[model samples]
Target: MSWTVDEVMTRQVVTVRPATPYKELVALMSRHAIGALPVVDLVDSDGRLVGMVSGTDLLAKERAAAGARRASRARAEQAKAHAETAGELMTSPVVTARAGDALARAARIMHRARVRHLPVVDATGRLVGILSRGDLLKPYLRSDESIRHEVATEVLGRLMDLPPDAVEVSVDEGLVTLRGELETSSAGDVAVRLASAVEGVVGVRNRLGYRLDASDPRMPPLPGARGLPAAEWGR
Candidate 1:
C-alpha cells in the first residue's frame, strides 16, 4: 500500500501574505507553535503559495540587526536587519510539494533542501495543506498485521500474479518473510522487490525457491567440436 502527502498532511495550515509585517509573522508563529508559514498571494483569493517565512529567517533579521549596532553593516545583513515585512524577510521561489505526491517524494525534497516543513500545493500552486517530517512517519506506526495483509493480497496476489496462498507471508515487527515455490528465479526476486515497496515494511527476506535453475551454465562444447589438433583428433 502506498501513502500520499494528503493522507497525513495538516489541512488547516497557518499562512501569511507577502506584505504582512515581520512582528506579526513572529506573533503568528508563536501562537501556532509552527516553525514556518507559507506566504500566499494576497491579491488572489485562491491563496497561491509564493514563498515561505521560517523562524530561522526571522532570527536572521534579529541577528543582523544586532550586528549592525557593533560595526559597519554587511550589505545583505543590512537589508535583512531593516526589513519590516514578511515579503522582505521570506525566502521566495519556495520549495514545496504537491498534495497528491508520494510520501517518499515529499520526504526526499525536505531532506535534500534541509527544510523541516513543506507547503502542500495543488496543480495550480494553490496552498492546500502543510506536511512535516512527523507526518511522513505516521505510516510506519501502522500495525504489522496491516502491512502483512497488503503484501500478501496486493503484492503477491495482484502484483506478482500468483495464487493468493502460493506464498506464505509472515511479519515480525516490520520485516516481511516470503517463502514458497515460484515459477522462475526472477519471480521470487520480483516478489521481494514488491514487498519492500509496501508502506510500513521495514525490510524483506526472500526465502522462496524456484522451479527453473536460471543460474546454471550452458553445456560445454562437445569433444569433437573443440577443434583439437589433427593428431589428438585421430587418437
Candidate 2:
C-alpha cells in the first residue's frame, strides 16, 4: 500500500501567529521540543501558512545581539537580527507539502529544500498538519510479514497476474527475496522493480528465473507476448 503525508504527518500542529513575540516563539518551541514553527495568518477561521520560523532564524538575532560584526553575514541576517516578532524574523515563500502527497515525494521535497519540517496544507492552502524527517521513517517500522505480503499479493498476484505459486516471496528484516520462474526476462525484471517499490522494503534480492530472454532482439517473441516493450523494460 502507498503511504501518504496525511497518514504519517502530525495532525495536531503547534503554530505561531505572524504577530507572535520572539521570546514567546522560543518558549513554545522549547516546550513542544520542535526546531521550527509555522508562521500562520488566521483568515476566515483558517490557519493560512504564511512563513516558517526556524532555530537558524532565531540564532541570527542572537549572533547579532552578541556583537559579532562579521562582514560575511548577509543583509537578510542583519535584518532578522533586529526583528522582534515572528513575522519580522520568519522566512517567507515557504516550501510546503500537500496532505495527499506521497511519502517518497515529501522526502524529496524536504531533501531538496534542506528543511527538516514541512507544513502540510489542504487544497485551499489552509494548514492541516505537519511533517518531519522522523515521520518519513515510520514506514521502516513495518513488520517484515507485512512487506512480504504486499510483494506477494499486490505486486505479483494482482499487478503481474501471477498465480500463488509463481513467485516465492520471503522477507527478513525488510529484505525481500523473490525466487520463482516467470515467462520472460522482462516479467522477472518488472517483478523485481515492483517489489523494490513496496513500502517498508529495505532491498530486493532477485533470484527469479525466466524461460525466455525478451531483451535479446535475436530471440523469438512468445505466443502471447506477456513481456513489456523494450523501452519500458529498459526502464
Candidate 3:
C-alpha cells in the first residue's frame, strides 16, 4: 500500500506573516533550521495561508536589495524601512496536501514543482500539518536489515527487465547495490535511476557489468538518452 503524506509530514510547522520584517523572517527560519515559512494572513477571523517565504526567494532578493543599501547611508537605514513584505515576494496559491495523499506522489510534486514545504490541510482547507523532503527521508534513513532488503529488491525490480534469475538485489545498511552482468552499459543507468528514485536508498554501487552493442539493440549512453522503450542489454 502507498504511504500517506500525513503519516510522514512534520507536525510542527513554523510560519510567519506577510508584514514580517526581512531580518525577522531570516532569524525565524534560521532558528528553526527551516527553508520556507508559510505566510499567514487573517480571513474571517481565522488564520489563512496566503503565500510562502522561502530561503531561495529571500536570498534572490537580498543580493540586489542589500547592495543598494550598502551604497549609501540613507539606503542602509532604509533596508528596514523599505524592506519588501512577504506579500511582495512570497509564492501564492499555495501547494497543499491532504492527510491521505501518497508520499510518493507528494515527493513527485515537490520534485517537479521545486518546492520544499508542503502544508497539509483538512477537507475544509484548515491547516493540519506540513511535510518536507527531509522529513520524508528520515524513516528510510533509519531502517534495519530486513527492511532494507525488501526496499532494495523493490527498487531493482523497477529499474531493469531482469531475466527471471539474472540479477540479484541486496541492501546493507542504507546501500542498495545491484549485482549481475547487465549485458550492456545502459542497464547500469537503469539501475542507478531506479535505485535513486526510491525514498531511502542512500548509496548505490553498480557492481553490475554492462553490455554494449553499437549495431544491436543494447544502447550506449547518448547524452540525452533515457531508459525508455527498453534498451536491449545483449540481444
Candidate 4:
C-alpha cells in the first residue's frame, strides 16, 4: 500500500535550539520517551529540518558534563565548560524521505542509511513532517488482515519457508476467525505455527480444531469428494 510521509509521519515533533542547555535536552528526551529530535536554529524557525540529535549523542554530552563537573579545575571554569553548542554534536543536513514513497522503500532507505529517523520533505526541500522507524514498525506490528486466506498464505509462506501457492489459506481479522482446508491434515499444525509467528497475530481461532474427513473420491456411486454421509451433507 502507498503512504504519504505525512500520513504516517510524526508531526507533533519535539525540537531543541542550537544553544539549548545540556540539562534541558536530557529532560526532554527522558520525559517524552523520544530517541532523538531536530535541532533548529531559533525556537521559531519552523523551516526546513536542519540538524538532528539522538539519545546516544545526548548521553555523551551528559558524560562530558559530569566529568567536567568532577574535575578539580576552578569552579568558574567548570560552569563555563558545561555549556555546549548544539552545532558541535548535532548531525547536519537531516536525512529525509519523500512523502509519496512506498512504506517498504522508506524502510529500506532507512536501513541502508543507518538512520533511525528521516524527516519528510516536499519537492522544494522544505520540512513537512518526520518519518521514523517506529512509525513504519507500528503499522506492521498492528497489521489486521480481513481474510483468513490471505493471512494464512502470507504467514505460512514466511514461517514455513514454503511457496505461497503451496498452501491453502484463509483469514478474517474482524471476529478473528481462521478457517482453511489444508492439503494434508498434518499441515494444520504447520498453519497454526505460521500464524503465531506474525507480529500482530494475537491468537489463532482455528476452526481446524479437528481433522478433515479424508475420503476416497474414486468411488463410482459418490458424486465427487466425500465429506459426510450424503443425507447429512445434503446431496
Candidate 5:
C-alpha cells in the first residue's frame, strides 16, 4: 500500500541545461510530447537539477509577444518573451518530489502547487525521474479479483478478526459491496471504511448489518476500536 513516486515515475526523463536554446527546448518538448523539462547544471558528470521550464512558461513568451493589453504588465512575462536560453526563462526554486516519497505525498504536493508534472529528485537534489498525475493512478488498474482477495483476507480476516467467510465481498469494476454481520455497529462502519481504502476501490456500498450498537455509552467499546480512527484505518 505504500506506493512511492519512483514506483510509477517515468525513469527515462528528458532534461535540459541552463544554456539550452529556446528552439531546442521547444523541439525537445514536441518530440517527447512532454509538458515540462527539468533544467539542470550539466557541468559535472551528474547533472544537478536547478530549475524547471514548463509549456506554460514557454507560452508566456508568446503571450507577451502578442502584446495583450492588461491593467498592469507582468514584468517577468515580458522578460521571458525576449529570453533566448533556458536559464533566462526557467522558473527557479522549482517545486519537486523526492523519488522515495509516498505517491499520496507527491499527489498532495502536485495538487497544492497546481502543477501537472513533478520532477523527482535524489537525496542530493539530482534529477532522477518525472511523476505525472497519470502515473499516480497506476494502482487503480489492479484487477477486481486481486482487490477481492485482499479485502477478504487482509481487511476482514486479519484486521477485523472476522472469519474469512463472514463477509461476502463482491467487486465489480472497482466498486466494492461488503455484505456481512458484525458484533458491533462501529465494526460495520470500520469494515466499510477499510474496504473503501483498498487500492483500486472506487466506491464502497455498505450492506453490512450489526448485532449490537456499540456506540451506546452504556455498552463496552469493541475490540480494535482504539487502534485507528475510521479515516486513518486503511491509510
Candidate 6:
C-alpha cells in the first residue's frame, strides 16, 4: 500500500492571514519553529489558501534595510524587500498538495516547484495540513520487520501473485534481499522492481533464479513456457 501526504503531514498547521504583519509572521514562525507559513484568506468561510511566506521571504526585508544591493536580485525579490505585510511579502500562486495525493507525487511537486514546504489542501482548496521535507523521511523510520512483511505479503504475494513460500524476503537496516525461484527472468526482474518500490526499502538484492530467459530475444521460447512476453514485462 502506497502512503499518502495526509498520512505523514502535520494536520495541525500554523497559518497566517494576508494582513498579518511581518513582525507577527516572524514571531509565529519562531514560536512554532517552522520554516514557512501558509497564507490564507480568512474572508472566505473556508479560509482558503492564498499564498506562502517563508524565512527567505522575511530575510528580503532585512537585506534591503541593510542596503544590500545586488543586480542579480529578481523584480519579485525587490518588491518583497520593501513589503511590510504577508500580503505583499508572500509568494502568490502557492504550490500545494491534496490530502489524498501520493507522497512520491507530492515530493515531485516540491522538486519541480523548488519548495521545501507544501500546504495540503482539500477538494475545496481549504488548507487541511502542511507537509515538509522532514515528513517525507518518516517512512524510512519503519521497523525492519515491517519493511520485510510488506515486501513479502504486499509485493511478492499480492502484487506478483506468488505463493507464500515462493519468495523469501529478508531485511536489515532497510536493505531487502529476495531469494526465490520463478518461471522467467522477467518475473524476477518485476519482483525486484516492486520490492525496491516498497516504502522503507533502501535497496533490493535480487537472488531470484528463473527457469527461462524470456527477456532475451535470442533465447528460443521453450515448449510449455508460461511467462509474460518481453514487451509486456516493460509495463
TM-score of each: 0.68, 0.73, 0.54, 0.52, 0.70, 0.74
* Model 4, runs deviating above 4 Å: 2-4, 42-46, 63-83, 141-171, 174-235
Which sections of candidate 3 miss by over 4 Å? Answer: 66-83, 142-235
> What is the C-alpha lDDT profile of model 3 across 40-98, one tens digit per residue?
77545477777778886677566655654345434333443344777666777888878
Pick by lDDT: 2 or 3, better one: 2
Residue 70, candidate 1: C-alpha displacement in angstroms: 13
Q: How many residue pairs clash in each candidate?
A: 0, 0, 3, 8, 0, 0
What's model 2's lDDT at 165? 99
| lDDT against the true structure, each candidate | 0.84, 0.88, 0.69, 0.62, 0.86, 0.87
Q: How far is candidate 5 from the true structure (C-alpha RMSD, Å)?
A: 5.5
Q: lDDT per residue, candidate 6, 1-235, as tens digits? A: 8899988999998889999999999999998899999999998668999999999888887887787766765677778777989999998898899999999999999999888999999988899999999999989888899999999998888877889998899999999998978887767877888888888888999888887676678988754344445454554
Model 1 CA deviation exceeding 4 Å by range: 1-4, 68-76, 103-108, 136-140, 168-170, 177-193, 204-235
Stretch of 10 with least lDDT, candidate 5 = 226-235
Per-residue lDDT over 191-217 for candidate 1, one digit per residue giving the tens place of the 0 to 100 score: 888889888889999999876566566
Screening candidate 6 with a backbone cut-off below 3 angstroms (N, C-alpha, C), the clashing residue pairs are: none
Error of 6 at 20 (Å): 2.2
Q: 1-235, model 4: which lDDT tens digit per residue?
A: 2344665788788877777766777788899988887776655554555677777566555655677344543453343444465555566767778888877888888899788888777887666677888788664444465335445555565544556555444434422344544554445655665566554456666665333434435524433233323453574
lDDT string for model 5 (1-235, tens) is 5678987999998989999999999999999999999999989867889888999888888788898534554877888989989998899888999988999999999999888999999888899999989998888897899889888998998887888778899999999998978776667777888888888899999888887776678877655674444555464
User: Worst lDDT window (10 residues) for model 1?
Assistant: 221-230
Model 5, C-alpha of 206: deviation from truth (Å): 7.1
* Per-candidate alpha-carbon RMSD to the true structure: 9.3, 4.8, 9.5, 10.7, 5.5, 4.7
Evaluated at residue 224, the lDDT of candidate 6 is 35
Candidate whose lDDT is highest: 2
